[model samples]
Target: MLSRDRKWFLVIGIICAMIMTSISAWQPQTANAASPSASKVDAVLVVDVSNSMNTSDPGKIGNEAMKMFIDMLSTQNDKVGIVAYTDVVQREKALLNITSEADKQELKAFIDGLNRGAYTDTSVGVKEAIRILQDGKTAGHAPMIVMLADGNNDFNKTTGRTESQSEQDMAKAVAEAKNSGVPIYTIGLNADGKLNKNKLADIAQQTSGKSFITSSADDLPNILSEIFASNLKLKVVPLQSITANGNYQDVTVTVPNDSVLEANISIMSSKPVDARLIDPSGNTKPIPSSDVLLSKSKSYSLIKLLKPVAGDWKLQVKGVRQDQIDINLVFNYDLELKLDAPPAQSYKKGDSVQIRSYLTSNNQQFQDQELYANMNAVLKVKDLDSGTTNEVSLTNAGDAFTGSYTIPDEHDYELSVRAEEKSFYRETQPITISAKAGAGSGTNTGTTQTAAPAEKSNLLPLILAGLGLLVLLIAAFFIWKAVKKANRGFVGQIVLEIRDENTGEKTYPQYKKLNTFRGKFNLHQLLQLAPEFSGTDKVVFTPANQDRIMVRSTPEITIEKSGRAVDTGSGLELKNGDRLTIPLASVDKTILLEFISVNS
Candidate 1:
C-alpha cells in the first residue's frame, strides 16, 4: 500500500514499459518483411578483342569495367561466363555455377588476361555467348548477354567474305539469341563516334534490351555497374508446339492489347520451310530475318511487334512434309503514360497551365472494361531548386485524364505522371520546365486572329483559256485511247501455262497481250489468281518493250531458268519457248511455266 501520487506514477511507468517492449518486438519483423528475395541470373560477358581495341583502350578499361560488373551482382545466387572474340571466338571462362567471392576473383583474372587480336568477329562472340548461357541456364535463372564492341564486324577479310556478308552473319546471331529468350545489352565504346551505334541499338531493341554509347573509357565502370544493378528481367510466355500434317499449316495466335509480342518457330525437320505472318489487319508481311537482326538460326524464325493490335495473328508455314514444330510466344506488357502540356520553355510566374495525360496499360488505351475502374491516376510537380513537390489527382477526360497546375515561382520545375492500381504501375518520363519569365513579361496566350478583306475582279478571258486547255486535253485522251485500242487488237500475245510437277496436270493458261504487258508486272499477283501457286512465296516478272520477260523469285525461294539455278536477287530474261521451273519439297511434280506467243 503506497500514497495516491506514487500509485499513479507506478501505473504510468508500467504502461510505458509495455509499449517499448511491443515496438522492440515488431521492428525486426517489419524489416524482414520489407526485404526482397534475391533473383537468380545467368549472365555472359562478350568482349571485343579486335586490334582497334588495343590502341583505343590501352588502359584495359573494358577489363576493369567487367570486374566491377561481376562485383555488383548479388552474392546470393548469380552465375556468369566470359567470351572473347576477334577473327575467331574463344571461351575465356566457363560458367561459374555459384557466384561466390572466389568465383569473382577467377572471372576477374580471366578478364585481365584478354588481349587484342586480329579483327572483329562480333557474330562469333555473340553466338558463343548464347551457346554458353543455353548450356548453363537452370530452371529459375534468367539468361543475359552483355556485349562490348569498339568497331563494326570487320572479320570478313580473314574469312574471305564481304563486309555486308559479315554483317548478315552478325544479324543472324542476334536473331538466334533473341529467339532463345536471351536479351543482349550492347555497349559501344566509340571514343570518336565512328562506331556503328545504330546497329548496336537495333540489336538491343529487337531483344528488349538496352544500348549505351560511351565516349570515354573512364565511364565504363559506372555504366557497367548501373546496368548490372538494374533488375531488368525478360518476361516470356510458355512454349506452344504444333505438328503439321500437310503441305502447309496455318496457326493463329491471339495478341493481347498493349504488349510487345515475339513469336519464334522451330521446325524439327531439316527441310527448308517458308514462313510469313498475317496481322490482325489481314496484311501479309515477310518475317524479319538475320539481315534485320531479328533472327539468327536457319531452322528457327523470329518476329516481333510492339503494341500489337488485339486480335488474331496468323502464322503460315510451308514445308515439304509433315513435321513437328515448336512455337514460343513471349509478351511483355508495361504501363505507358504520356503527358501533353504547352511548351515549358517560356512560362510566366503565376500562370495557370493545363496538363493532360494519356494513360495506356501495356500499350493499349483504357476502355470501359473489367480493369478500368480500378486504376488510380495522379500528377506530380516538383520544384528542382527548392525541393518542393505537389501531387494532384486527375479527373477522367474520356480518352485521357486532365489536371491543372499553376507555376509557383521563377525556378525550374520537374513534372511526372503516375498511374497505378494493384500490380499495374506506370510512370511517364520526367519533363523539365525552364526558369519562369519575369512578371508582366510577354507569355504565350495562345489567342490571336487575323482576317483579310475579299477582292473582286473579272475573269472571262482566264475562264475561256482554262476551258480551251481542258478541251484540248480531252481530245488528246480520246486520240490516245483509240491508238491503244488499235494496237491491242493487232499486237502479239504471250501465253503462260502452269503444270504440276508430279501430276502433270495443267491449269488454265494466262494470256497477256504483249503490247499491254510492256511494263513491269508482279508475277506474284498473277500467280495468286491461279490455283497452281497456292504455296508460292513471291514472284515478279517484267516484260520489256524488247521481246523478253525478266523473272525473279522472292528472297527465300530459289528459281531455275532453263535448268540453271539463278540467284534470287538477280532476274533472268526468257524469250519465247523458254521454260521456268520452281521445285517444291512437298509436291511430287515441279512447277513448270512454259511461255508461248500468239499473234492477235
Candidate 2:
C-alpha cells in the first residue's frame, strides 16, 4: 500500500511541471502593449482627354503615359478613384469603387480603352473628382487628388469664361473637400513643350504639391513616385511631461504616424538622455526614449496609453544620429483626413486678403492627440495674379502648421490634395497673403485682403536733387568773393599754402578759383559726422617723412597721422578727416592763405 501511494505522488508532480513550462513559453510581448493607432489614406486619380493626349506619335507622348500610370495604379493596393475630362468632366463606369478582383478587372479594361480627344478642362475635372469624393458614403483616410494633363485650359475659352469663373466653381468643390481635408497632386504635360511653366508650376505649388513635366510616356511613373515620396510626413512629439523631486523629469516620445502606413519606422538621433517620467506615486522613473518604432512605423507613439500622472518632464531628438550620421528616414503615411473646403473668401483685385484656414490630422489616434496637435494641408490652385502668395508650411517640427494664401483670379477656383489634419501653430508664422492693385477695371475683380500696409516707391532722384541745389549756392558765393578780392588773372590763385616742419620749407601752389560748385550741402552746425577710432596701435609712420607743424606744441602746418585701422563687422571704414586734434604752437612761414572752401 505504501509503494502505491508514493507512485501516485510522483505522477502528480510531473503533470504540474509540464503546465508551468507551457505557460512561460506563450507569454505575450509586454513592450508593444502601449502603441499609437494608425489612420487611413484616400487618393483620387484624374486623367486628361485633351487633343494633345490623342496624338501618340513619340513626341512627348503623355496620352499613352496616362494610361500606363493608370495601369500601374491598377496594381497598387491603394484606395483610389478615377475621373476623365475635356471641355466638361466625366467618370468611367467603374469610377469610385472598392478594389476587388472584378473591380480591378473592369478598371483595367477601362484604362485600356481610353482615348484622348476633347479639350482639357483641368479645373472642371478637379471639380468632379471632389464632388464624387465628398458625396461618397465610404469614409476612410485623408482624400488626395492627382491629375495629369497637357494643354492650356479650354474650359474657360470655350465657355467665354475666365479663370476667375473657373476658380469660383473650383472654390466650391475645394470648399467641400477642405471640409473633408484633401491634398492634391498635379502633373503638367507640356507636349508642345511650350506650356506656361511658371503658371502651371505656381498652381501645383500652391496646393503644397509638386508639378512634373514628362516628355515621354515611360517616365511618368517615376515622376508620380516622387510625388508619393513627398507625401511622407515626419514629426517628433513629446509623449508626456513629468516632474519629480530634485529636478529629475520623465518624458515619452511620439514620432510621426501614417495612414495605411508601410515601411519600418526608424530614426537617427542622439541616444535618449536619461528620459524619465513621474509615476502615480510621485516618484520619477525613466521613460524609454530611443530609435524605436512607434506602432511599428504605423502610428505616432510606440506606446498607446502613455500618461504622466505626476511630474514635469521634456523630450529631445536630434536630426542626426550619435557618431553624427545623417538621419535616415523611410516610411509611408496612411492618408485620411476630412477636407473642409478650398478657400471661399475673396477680395478686390490688388486687395490684401487671406484665403481660409485649412488642416488635416490623425483620425484613428485623434481621440488623444486632438487635445494637443494636428497637421496642415497641401493644395493646387490655378489663375493667381499680382501679389500671389506661395503655399508654405508654418511648422514642420510638429503636426500643427498654418498655410499661406495668394491672389490670382476673380472667379470660382479648384484645389486638390491628399486628405490630412490642418491646424494653426502659435509659433508658426501666421499665413497672410494679400495684393494691392490699381483701383481700376480688369479681369481680376477678385482679391484676397489683409490689413493695409504702406506701399514701397523709389525716391532716390528726389533726394539727389535736394543735395545738388545746396551745393550750387555755396559755390556761387565763393566765386563772387574771388571776383571782389583781386583782378581776374591774379584772382585765379586764391592763395592756398602749407608749411613743412621737417624740411622747414614753405610750399605755395597756384590754384584756380571755382566758377561754380553745386548740390545740397550739410548744415553748418546741425550735422557733425565723425567716426570713433579703435584698434589704432597698428598705426606707425617714419618721423623723417613727417612735418612737426602738424603735431601738438610744434611748428606744424599739416596734421599727417599714422596708418592705424579700426574694424567693423563689414570691414574697416574710413572718413577723409577723422582725428583727435592737438594744438600747434608755431609755423615757419608767415604768408597769408586764402579760405576758398577748405574742403575744395
Candidate 3:
C-alpha cells in the first residue's frame, strides 16, 4: 500500500509541474475572431483598503462590487489581476494571475483573506501596482492600471526629499507606464463616504477610464461594468454629416482618456474633402500625404485626435464623405468673425467728435460652408451726427479696423453692431451693441464755445489819467532791450515810454526782448515753466486787465508746449508777494492760444 501511494503522488507532482511551466510562459496572444479588437487588453484593479474606507460607503460598495467582479473574471477570464492598497499593498500578496482553475481558486482565497486595514498610502500603492504592470514581460498586450482611492493622494513625502521630489518620483512612475502605452485608470472613492462625482470624473478623464459618484453601495457594480466596457466597445453618435471627400464636423468624440487610450474614427468621402484642423492655440494642420479621390462611392475619411492634450478642441471639417456613411452631410461651414468696440464716448451739445472701433473672429478662419458669403459687416452708430454709417469687412482685421465717426453737438451716442457674411448660409448672426460717442468736441472747441453774456464787468476799466499808465504787462518776462523782435522780432519796432504811478518807475521802459538768432522763426513753442507744484483749485496767476490770461505759441512744433498766464488786475495775480488770492489752477502744462477775431 505504501509503494502504491508514493507512485500516485509522483504522477500528480509531474502533472502540476507541467501546468506551472505553461502559465509562467503564458505568452498570452490575441485570438483571431470575426470582429477583432484593435489590441489585446490586460487590466489590473488596485483597490484601497485604508481605515477610513472601513467607515465609508464607497469603500463598502467597492468591496462588494470587487468581490463579485473577481468571481466573474476568475471564472470567465482574460489576462486579469488585483492589488489591494492601503498603508501599502495590504494583501499579504502582490499580484494574482488567474489564468487557470488552480490559480482562480488561489485568487478566491486571497480575496477572502483581505480584511480591512488601518490606513492608506494611495500613492505608494499606485506606484507599486504600476511597477508590476511595467515589469511583467507581457508584451503586445494593451496594458491598463486601475487604481482606486477614497481621498486625496496624501502619501508622506519621501524622507530627506522635498515635496517636489516626491511628486516627481510619483510622476516618473506614471510617465514610465504611459510611455509604454499603459493607460492608468483612476477611481476616486471620495471623502464624502460616497463617490465624489467631480473628482471621479477627473480621475477617469486623466487616466482614460471611468468615474462613478455612487449614492449607495448598490450603484458600484453597474459603474464597474461601465468602466470595464468602456474599452470593450465605443458608441459613436453622428451629430451631423459633411459632403463627400470632406472632414468631420464638430465631431465631439467622448472616449474616457483615463486609460490614456484613444481611438480614431474614419469616414471615406467620394471626392476631395479637404480637411483643415484647428487646435486650441489657433494652429492649423492639414492631414498630410493623404488625399480624397473624386469617386462618388470610394472616398475615405478619418479624424484622429492623438497625443491629445486634455481639453476641448474645435475641429473644422472641409470636403466630402462617401455615401456609405448614411449621413446627411452639408458641404460647408460658416466663417464667423467678431469686432469688439471700446466704451462709448460723448460730447456737449453741438460737439462733433471722431470715434473708433476694433475687430476679432468669433470662429477661427473661414468655414467652408460660408465660403460664398458676402464680405460685408454692419456698424451702426446711434446718437451720432445723422448720416454717419459704416460697412466693415470680416475678410479684414476685426480689431485694427478702427471704424471712426463723428458725434456732432450731441450730448451722448449709442453704437449698434453685427458682422454679416451672406452666402450659401448666414455664416453668423448679428449682435447688437451700444457705445456713447467715443470722442467728441475738439480742443478749444469747448473753451471758445458761446458763454452767457459775461457777468456785467463788476468793476469798470479804470480811466484815471496823469500817469501815462506803464501797466507794462510784459507777457514774455525775459528781457532783451529790443535789439530785435521779427513779425514781432526787432528788425525795427516802436514802444511808448510810459511811467508807473505806484513806484514812479519805468522812467525808461525796460523793453522785454528775445535773444533769438533772427530768422523766419516759426518757433511754435518757447519759455515752458511750472512752479513744480500745484493745487486743484489754487489761483496760479492773474493779469491786471483781461479776465483770463492769453497763452501764445507758434504752430507745427514737434515738442509739447508749456506755461500759462492771466491778467494781474484787481491784485489777483500769480506773482510772489501778492496778497490777492488767484482764481483757478491746472497741473497740465497745456494751454491753447485763440485768435480773438476783431469782429468780437
Q: Backbone clashes in each candidate structure, one number apiece?
A: 8, 98, 60
Give residue 554's lDDT in candidate 2 (0 to 100): 18
| Model 1 accuracy (lDDT, Cα) | 0.59
lDDT of 1 at 133: 78
Which ranking of candidates, highest TM-score first? 1, 2, 3
Model 3's C-alpha root-mean-square deviation from the true structure amounts to 41.1
lDDT of 1 by residue, 17-73 (tens): 545544454332210011122235788888887887766555555665566556545
Error of 1 at 232 (Å): 5.6
Each prediction's whole-model lDDT (CA): 0.59, 0.38, 0.39
Superposition TM-score, candidate 3 onto the true structure: 0.31
Model 2, total clashes:
98
Query: TM-scores, in order shown?
Result: 0.34, 0.32, 0.31
Ranked by lDDT from best down, the candidates are 1, 3, 2
